[model samples]
Target: MTTRTSHVDTFARDRLPPPQWQPEFLFELPELQFPDRLNCATELLDRWVAQGQGERLCLQAPGGVRWTYADLQDRANRIAHVLVREMGLVPGNRVLLRAPNNPMMAACWFAVMKAGGIAVATMPLLRAKELGQIIDKAQVSHALCDAALAAELQLAAAQHPVLREIRYFHEETPQGLEAAMARQSPSFDNVHTAADDICLIAFTSGTTGVPKGTMHFHRDVMAVCACWPRHVLKARADDVFIGSPPLAFTFGLGGLLLFPMSIGACSVLLDKASPPMLLEAIPRFGATVLFTAPTSYRAMAAQAGQLRIGAPRGGSLRKCVSAGEALPVATRALWKEHTGIEMIDGIGSTEMLHIFISADEAHARPGATGTVVPGYQACVLDDEGRPVPPGTLGRLAVKGPTGCRYLADERQRQYVQHGWNLTGDAYIVDEDGYFHYQSRTDDLIVSAGYNIAAVEVEDCLLQHPAVAECGVIGVPDEQRGQIVKAFVVLREGHVPSQAMVRELQDFAKRTVAPYKYPRAIEFREQLPRTETGKLQQFKLRSV
Candidate 1:
């Protein structure tokens, strides 16, 4: 593979970890092979149009705007022209993108890639402080953001000298990027980037309170599409993909954008994909595949009867994917009972780029994260980095076509050790070769000399009808090193009372081992969640 590029800003390339620190990449599958010179944007967008799928629907927004492959390519090409000719964006310059999951956000992402600029997509909900960290870390020179989401970006740019320019899109002002796109040529020859060229920088949620930028190559993006989607998802060209995770997150990036586009499928982009909005859109658009978190699935299952009004007869949803957090067994069972569809549970991380362990509908087990995707290799390893015995919980490690490459972060060495990406998740692989998630290594609760997975207690609580949502964590205790504490949100018509707590405690005791039941339960209006909807158990523990 070629190493050098025409990039003027080689900061990302220069700052990459030494070759010895990188995971051993495997492109053994025929589909995983790639040409030495490749630009992902050209393959995912332009190539589809060149192959006569130009008129095929690529994106359908909530406001009734539909864009075909050709439409997307044209918009992206024009945006690329504006970045180069007007903004002086050079190859490998980092470009920040901020917007909801809409057509233009996708266009901006493709445009940055097409122009050979690294695309750093930020979650729209991030504040100035959070955005400032990303801008400063990535050394972003330019930004293309939705007008509605520009306030924070502007504030972030004001604090960083490297962020020299910010361009707004879909704004009424003539100075907006849309205006520039309208004046430029629609056809663009994408920059000839190497397959290993850094194309995206996805930041972690900073559970440790310091975000790390995960660098992914162009081939990494194509690798994810070839692995998970080809093996587990097996989606078709006509499959209508819909999801709630923000595109900034790798889960949503793969599910809503890369996977669907790679298969020449269309996707429904919702600026706000709440349970009600997702439920309504599925029947209206005849969505065949849905992607969301376990929490959302549980919420929808509780309101399944009310969703029948506009839902397709026999249901248009053929597959449901749960990620961004561990999928609770109770949520999976409830979803299957309501929709007649098994929720496909998988485990992935921003560092690896997409889901590497998953099971197809035919093979999905209730509590397992599923088998490793075809192109990846996974194992549970102990502290010494040796593989743990089957059924023993240890750190989950994986290595394949895509792996961790944190930009200029010393933590890269900690994440990737002995040529494997230690994904921070604890798991156990059964004799049957299925992987079962235990908890994040930090989430393991050691109570009275017993290691209890927080998810286990939370899953048990979710089975109770009165519990709408809950997050379990370990709190300090003098007698016991730490004790299980659960923060719960009660369902409507359910009032919190000492009697109710006792009933829930008894219910959990019957469900799991008596010692695993939460010793302390606190009722709240709702649980803390990240922008992507993953439960903030760390926050609950702090409280």
Candidate 2:
């Protein structure tokens, strides 16, 4: 790929991994082809208006505020003017965006991309210390945050000298970005950026708790849309997308904003999307596609009565996607039973940009994570980075147009090896070519010379009626080197007692291998989880 003239100095491009370490990119698919000079915002947002789709609805907010493609394009252009003329934002300069899933957040994201600036969107729940770390690590110079959620960023900016300017939006005050944007021109030209220009820097937490910045290019954004939504998702232009994952998360960024807009479709944004809120929003907005995690799906399945009001009657919700973590077989079955929709289980990460392994409704299996997405190649590799035989558990390695490019992080070498991105997942591929997720490589527990996948054990425990949530880990034991220990959160009516523990153990034995049953069971009010709702197994291990 040829590097085009970047308006601002390309800090992220300069920090990319060495050429040899980069994965082999594939753009042979007609949909993946792009021009040398391209602006993603122009393609995703502006083109819809230029092509006579301006009147089409683009965004639906919880407050009943709707935006057409023309409205979204005008706001994005005005925000771009604010970034360049008022905020002194230069191309390639990193802009930290902190907001929930709303129209303004989506507009600001496109504005940053339109102005040739890299967007570093953070979750609203991140604390001051975490925000400070991201600000320092990304060398962020400016921020566009929701005025309601600006407290933590204010505290973070106080400590980080690199964060020179902070602008609040969604506020009626004169100092807010929204007010500033209103005064600027609503017509601005998109920056002529290279197809490979870094447009986003997504931060993800590692096992050590430090955040790693994953740099993605404008082409990558378009690549994921072409590969996943075009082939697997197969969403129509009339589809209405809605989801619970925060827009800061890549999963939500793609599903809620990018993918929907790529096809001229619309999306409904909810600032607070709990399970109940999601259930209520579906029929309220006439949502056709849903994106969220498996845990949320499981909770909604348990409360099926609440979902019936806006449920799957008349094919209102044609698709349901589950990601962020592995979708347990039990959760998938329960959700399918409740909604008559087979939950599409996918596995994507900040490093990979979006879902590269998934199946449509037809090819989906109960427990399998589907085949490698089009334009990507995946394989199960052994310790030496060589492909393992079918059905043998090993590291999951994938290579495609989009791959890991850590921003000046040493872990880059560990993540990408020999031109293949080594996803830190333990998986087994069956003869039919479906990937079965066993566990994260770090989550595998070994006890008495047996390698036990914590996910398998947790799945078994989840089948018991008393278990609401569970985390399994290997704890030191004098007798067996290590023993499987389960920290469980019981349902509302269930009592945590010795009898319940015995019953859970017996249930696990009947569900999975006897050796995989939890030797020690500890009940908890709730399991430790990250802001993104992933189980923090390391925290459970310490307990």
Candidate 3:
């Protein structure tokens, strides 16, 4: 376990422009402290909106539009009034928000929180079929959506009558916000909400099958902001959080919205954050901290010099965090190679609400996920629930303030054993106390009477220069029960050949246990990933 900080730059000969002076460094925030009484609704964000109402730069979109903390609170207050007085919505009702990363969407989210309604936010790209399932599961009645995407909801609503009325809010609305803003009062009273009151019902992108709605309390939302954003990133009032993850995903909700608001910091939301869009947005917004997945980091790093994106401008972006999937060691090294900053990788699940374990730059182990976050405890348990010893792999179980409580589903028993939420991941802890992720329990590959971790093989394949992205799984083999199968995406200019396949197969064999080598390989343009950048192994398993 090596943890040292130094500045090193790596760029190819064709990548550099002459030296344009090094950037200055900004002072970082103090170490984190957990709050005793945490609640996302009236306790955390609304309190900040009241105390820091006059702060000018609070929220901004990719278009350079800005809003003060007061502006956001005023709009959210007005929206809350519309929901209560006009729509006849009452406290504890479920109101669905379906929109892109727009200002109104942010306003609606906090407004829903302010009115003591549970907000169920769906991604903008969700189709009718997927949309209907969530609407049905959450029993959502009134949906707030961007006017541009409301027609899709209209079609979805026709299928599910539970979603009777769809409300539209857009920054571009011609009638203006006078009616919308005037509909609510800024002096609205805070509805008394218990800490256990359900504040959100977020659907997990079940890569395996139907999405599961993970119920979270208002306290859990703020609990995550206090534990994760505080301990790992230590976001300050001045830090500007930026990310490519969608707010629909808990990863984005915590990193982009809740975390920033908890600290009175600002956030930059990009409606469409592709590699190129992020390249332009990060520097243009003067983003101080970045939250994205490993895949995006790899893609961004590959083009860093060409796009001029990774360089710190105005000492912004002191921290870069990656989640949603294992951060490839090569990608982490490559990102540090380019930016002179370590890429912090963490594991989080919707059931837990946000990241429970992550590596801070100061405490990072390159290939290993960081130790369990404070206020959380983890154990590796065997099938019989006995704890496994160090250096041995087993199911990862965790117990903490934030735990899984499935929405109207009995499957909760299958995941939560005793007080520990059995995170579906398999991992091994070394004698040194560092934990290394092996693979998801369902993703473990068994071939030729041997157990193999798909992640170990994939991580090895990622080290190969020609391999850009890859997925490893166990495929049915007549002779060997199951065999390793690899789905690879090659680098832009590199073509896969028979020799290249053999070379990658050989590389895995040498880098890992012999049984873990991929006996079969297929080249593809891209590996399927969730909106949060989690690899869809189920999609690969189907093929």
Per-candidate clashes, comma-separated: 0, 0, 1
Candidate 1, clashing residue pairs? none
Write down the lDDT of every candidate, Cα atoms only: 0.86, 0.85, 0.73
Which stretches of candidate 2 lie above 4 Å from their native place?
305-312, 443-543
TM-score of each: 0.83, 0.83, 0.75
Q: Model 2 Cα displacement at 275 (Å)?
A: 0.4
lDDT of 2: 0.85
What is the per-residue lDDT of model 2 for residues 1-543, given as tens digits with 9 covering 90 to 100? 486557575777788888877777777788888888888998899899999989999999987799999999999899999999998988999999999889999999999999999999998767676788899898999899999988888988999988987889878899988789879998998889998899999987654446789999998998998998899999999999999877888899999999999999999999988888988888889899999877678778756544653235454788999887777788788887877788788988789999999999899998899999999999999999999999899999998889999999888888889888888889999999999988767754545434466776787788888889998887876434467899999999999899998999888775554667899999999888999999998898776
Q: Can you write out model 3's per-residue Cα lDDT over 1-543, one digit (the tens) per residue?
A: 012111011111112112221111111223223233333656545676556555656789965689887778778888888877777676667788887786778888888877778789987766676678788877787788887777668878999997765678763553434456765578666566656566788886443335578877666776777677777787688888888777888888888888888777889988888777887787788887898877677778856645445544233557898887666677788888777777777888888888878778888988898888766777789998889999888988876667777766556766777567887889898787677888767765545334456776777799999999999888876445468899999998888789888999888765544556899999999989999999998999887
Worst 10-residue lDDT window for candidate 1 reads 304-313
Alpha-carbon RMSD, candidate 1:
10.0
Error of 1 at 461 (Å): 29
Q: What is candidate 1's CA lDDT for residue 446?
A: 56
